[model samples]
Target: MKARITVMRTVGAAVMAGALAWGVVTGAQTDTPPQDASVEAVADAAPGYAVEDYNYPQADKILAEKNIVLKRGDGHIVLADCASETGLLEVWARSRDKICFKVTGNSGWLTLEIPSVYGVKGSADQTAQVDMTVGSEEKSFDVAKNSFAAVGESADEQGRDYMLVEIRTAK
Candidate 1:
């Protein structure tokens, strides 16, 4: 019985490995865009603010490789603005998601920016908190005074992993 169990485990691991391999190959294939298209064309299709101003060096490369355009701006990174501008705010995978923004517009009025997939985990008030896990580590951050907080392992630290952002409005 023990020998049989060992054989079953090995077979299961092999199947999982095969599926992961297939995902890496085929998943990557579908993301690539046309070779002849210009950078402008690629930028036009990206979500977020303006592609030129956002300074996510690593994300830029990833998006480019995937043929996705991301809108970025310099001064204020408002979640409402991004949502209003892009319309499709929940398009990224959990692992590669990060919220980057600069506070702008009204002093009291703020836009809470987070990956559309995760949604708003807490209230929109001044003091809000949420729990998120990236890989094996779990952490929590508070939203206060219109600040930006991201919950994801750094690319440098952890190859690639899920991240959550919690934006809280000031009271």
Candidate 2:
């Protein structure tokens, strides 16, 4: 009778331990909390996306400060103080005198407006092409590296004034 009671107690303890282990495993597997409406609402609170338009930055301030109407560019060319550095492309116009631009990268382009442009001085390492217009007619000039080239009225037989509109350069 004593042996039977001991055996039955041991069996009961084993069954209880097995049940506890199964409960622990089932609880662990379902530990993740249920999703609620608050979780969905958090997604709407995130920030929006960003986009780039490529328009010239601070153009109005530049125009106000320098009297140059900078329109657009690939960000490879920019206006610079004439005395700031050497090897800058120089644009000569009757109204603006000499304006300088610094060129960077392998190639670049800038579109701007400078009236009465007659000549361009190219940078040392890159050749340049200048586009001008007078009335409805358009013209293009090739400027050799590190040299002064006549354009606009100086190049035209009729001596018509031209507005410098665009500049393209390559290394």
Model 1 Cα shift for residue 32 (angstroms): 77
RMSD score of candidate 1 (Å): 25.9
Q: TM-score for all predictions?
A: 0.24, 0.71
Instruction: List CA RMSD, all candidates.
Output: 25.9, 11.4
* Highest-scoring model, lDDT: 2
Tens-digit lDDT string for candidate 2 (1-171): 999999999999999999999999887687466776233567678888886665778999989988888898998888888899899999998956599999888998999999999999998889999999999999999999899999999999999999999999999
Model 1 scores worst on lDDT over the 10 consecutive residues at: 107-116
Reference-based TM-score, model 1:
0.24
Model 1 per-residue lDDT tens digits across residues 1-171: 999999999999999999999999888777567798655667668777754644434555645564333333332324322334322112233544433333343322222222322322222324334334555765565544333333343322543454443333233
Model 1, stretches more than 4 Å misplaced?
1-125, 154-160, 165-171
Q: How many residue pairs clash in each candidate?
A: 8, 0
Error of 1 at 160 (Å): 5.7
**Which stretches of candidate 2 lie above 4 Å from their native place?**
1-50
Give the per-residue Cα lDDT of candidate 1 at 33. Answer: 75
What value does the lDDT take at residue 33 in candidate 2? 66
Query: Cα lDDT of model 1 overall?
Result: 0.42
* Distance from true location, Cα of 31 in model 2, Å: 16
> Which number leads on TM-score?
2
